[model samples]
Target: MSEGPGATAHRAVTVRGPLSDARASEQARGDHHAAPLAAASWLLTTAMDLHRMAGALAEGLTAESGDDAEAVARLTSRWTSLHRDGGPPAEHTRLEALVEIRRPRTRRPALLWQWSGADPVAALAASSGRLARELVAVSQAAPLAEAFVGPVVLAPETAVHFVHETLGHSLEADNYRDYAAGCGLVVGSTVAGPQLTVVDGPLPGLETSRPRDDEGHTSRSTPLVEAGVVAGVLTDAREARRQRLPRTGNGRRAFGAAEALPRMSALHVARGTTPHAELVRPVRHGLYCRGAWGGGSVEEFFVVRPACAEWIEDGELTGRFVYGFDVKGRKISGLGALGSVGDDMGVFNPVTGCGKYGQELPVSMRSPSLAFDRLCAVPIAPASPSPPP
Candidate 1:
């Protein structure tokens, strides 16, 4: 791949963290026992000028490495400080301590992409007409303006929410395998109305672009639902064949060696007709949901946190609710309960990755602000993870 400005290069190695490779391999082979993790990291140049050199090194390694096992061992040794069976314990302790030593930094509006051109950012900047109007409405309607200030792009946020709630969590093949709730359970079931449709594609215009999945397959969009009916399950090649469905290019991985699984990319909710104003005004006692921070849902039971919600009273935009909602019941049930869908769709580029089966990768979601008749909500509380060791 050609390297551009602001680009850098690195060499990587994978190793077990707080665990041994033998233990990780055993666990992977289904002899599950408690183990920390098999982790990987890289040591590379930070200068943008080293991009070409980095690429060349990576290509050289792949071409010249004698074998997979030898390559992996060399990479692991170079990137990680191996502590065979027994170490001074000082090494492990120091590494554990180092994890929390770095001070948290303020987040900024930064761009992260590979081999990107100037056109995409330009498109996002130019497409802000509707977003600008929506943000004005949100800002004015917000109970407190000072609390909400940044590059407020509504369309992208809307797209993200839609994909997260409706697509990403919904299409997981594991959920389908377990006969779990939400989109998976109703795979072949028909929809009740025109309120549902989902498609995942790495379409050129969408932000979550992937030319080829880690599984070495050309990417393409996979339709999961259509016109509120249970159309199909998202599938990788394996699941596609097993379930007798077409491979939707959902195969993805954390890296080249990691096993692939069905994952969503550039999920898009089917187009709808409800105008932005119309979706908001009709909510007599509901919320205009926007931007989601993070969430976890199992079998359609989930709690969306740090989400921005505006209280709707009468037929007008109202004040902000500040807190988020805990959506209970079956996920598909809730989706089946969708009250209205909006016309504008957006994609979110969160500074986070999607983790499944211990692999993490960059992902994005797209959706529009939605309103429901009876969404569950609650107050925020203290977190459990240690602030910093």
Candidate 2:
């Protein structure tokens, strides 16, 4: 919260594009109608002068706010424009048209589509159209399934989210101490197997992505997991110094928050050669989590609310749907139980925000489908809201 030379700020708002999503996501959340979304005031965060703090940074902050905030405010009429029934148009869905500033612009402009096969920018328009249709179709396809336990194939979107909630959050430098003390997450220890790797960095040309951290540290990729080992943890200037670790450019803050802390920007779980279609090949009886309600992790325990899932029998989808299922497991056990990783790394702009310590931030994840062996899922109440993570 220091108003120093390295200070940085972010402007944000939540919106859903196209009229259909505004209506559908309402139902997706078990609401009868799409309620209006309102954005809060801009957040300005200050921390140690990253240049002075970290000698070899890639860039520095400037006094002039010559970036997307101005344009975004103008378009939203300082947010009065957000009153419109529909949100940002389809052509502007990828968000490249509205703003080019990556370091400080974070907006949940829309949650139209989720795709896993190609470049995010090029596929945004088509992906949203396709996914919006899928959301409706999947939800209406069938009734909920009975409680079950076995192998499970988490869709690309849900899989990345599982990693984000479990492993990614544990990698935050400040959160590392808490987990290490109680959850057995040792830095140099091999927790997840060699088949997986996770990273958090300034992934340019993606929505809700950041180039430099809030503390003015340049966008640098920090390895959270590499070839199955807990390679490194994320850190802002304060935590890095406090913990005697290197800064990872992961500092972030939200409006109405006390200060910037280490957080993720573009979280990526490396892909594998397994085809998306063949992910369920080994599952004799299990669930295929097509979409997720939301998930959370505390210490080592975690729970994922899969909004829509299909039963898999004899290595194929049974075509019957299951609704409102919770997949619960321990972090280390789940990672070690990873059965397969798909090549189709999904890119998504979900409406559900990532919340930490009561602050919510718009973020995105690119991950592939993941299959796990011996995952136990129980049925939950049918109609409920996704709890904040």
Candidate 3:
């Protein structure tokens, strides 16, 4: 292991076993006919003597986790991609495995679990065993209910995506300096409900938790949003110096890669007094997502695909599986839609990392189940639910 974040810990050792990069791309796709997450087109690579290297690079990966099953499931979707780019020693002995679990009635709503690591046996066993259980959860699901395109009740596992995308990305110094400001995300302003509070810092006992940033600054909590207001922005040493702002220890970068930039470490969304189940008790014509396959954002538009969901009507879940549903909308619009926050908080230390400027870095997030309104829910084909009541 590297001693310091800035130190280039290049391993030049020879491998005698099967080792693969488990950093997965576990994003769920909306298409039924499209290639599954397992269809990673990996090319063979060879690294023997000096100046010799070979690998199987995977593209179009969905990002998964560990109590943190939500993170594992998400990163493992596109799990079989092994990188042999002759850059890092770990890349030379990488492996990827994807497990597909179908509901028997239809293939449209299949459960995918992917794993990657140096050891193929361990990776496969982990991915397959976990996904098998989730498949059972949706086994008795009603015939792929028709899509519901309205408000949503997101569980803690799914709620992290909401804050990570619309709110988390918005607080990045670069984002705030560029696009977010134009979208009305000004600092020191109330952007969410009074109950909503978001903080970015290193968490103890969490995987990939950085005690210090890549640039050698002690990691400290940076409040991005407090009581629904934009309280702080993440900054690296460079940005802090340039903007005359506090360097919040968020500077990050990939090893042997480019320079570090301001980034998020462990994001903590404070829990509310409301119970988790209560959020769904009032939804009459919406879907309740229990977990997410994966999610991301592009400027103002954000999309989070629900891996497992239930139909809610008459103030209770129907216990029916809702598949292929997408929660998407303008980031700014979703800010004020905080209906409720749950007391159950989830910590996600996924195998997959966040990407920006072509650099991917490992990160973790924590949040409670959050309820929001006004965001559109778009269910894909073959699993459409009935119209709202």
Best by lDDT: 3
Model 2 scores a TM of: 0.67
lDDT string for model 3 (1-389, tens) is 23222222111112111124322222333231232323222211211110011110111011111011111211122211121122222211122333333222232434544333433334344334334434544543444345455668887667888889887887888887888877877887777789999988977634446666666677898888888888898998778888789989888767556467888877889989888778878787777776568788788778887676776788887766656667888888877777888888765555556788887765567788888766677755554778999
Decreasing lDDT order of the candidates: 3, 2, 1
Global Cα lDDT for candidate 3:
0.60
lDDT of each: 0.44, 0.57, 0.60
Clashes of 2: 0
Better of 2 and 3 by lDDT: 3
Name the runs in model 3 displaced over 4 angstroms.
Answer: 1-133, 137-147, 380-389
lDDT of 2: 0.57
Error at 101, model 2, angstroms: 31
Instruction: In candidate 2, list every pair of residues with a backbone clash.
Output: none
For candidate 3, what is the TM-score?
A: 0.67
Instruction: Report the lDDT tens digits of candidate 2 across residue range 1-389.
Output: 22222222222322222222211111111110222211222111101111111111111111122222111101010111111112221111121111111223434121123322223224544444434433433434454556676788888767877888888788888788767435766677787667788887766434556556655566688888888888888887788899899977777765435467788777888888889778888788888887666788888887887657777889887767766568878888888888778888776654345888886765668888988887778766656878999
* Model 1 worst lDDT run, 10 consecutive residues: 93-102
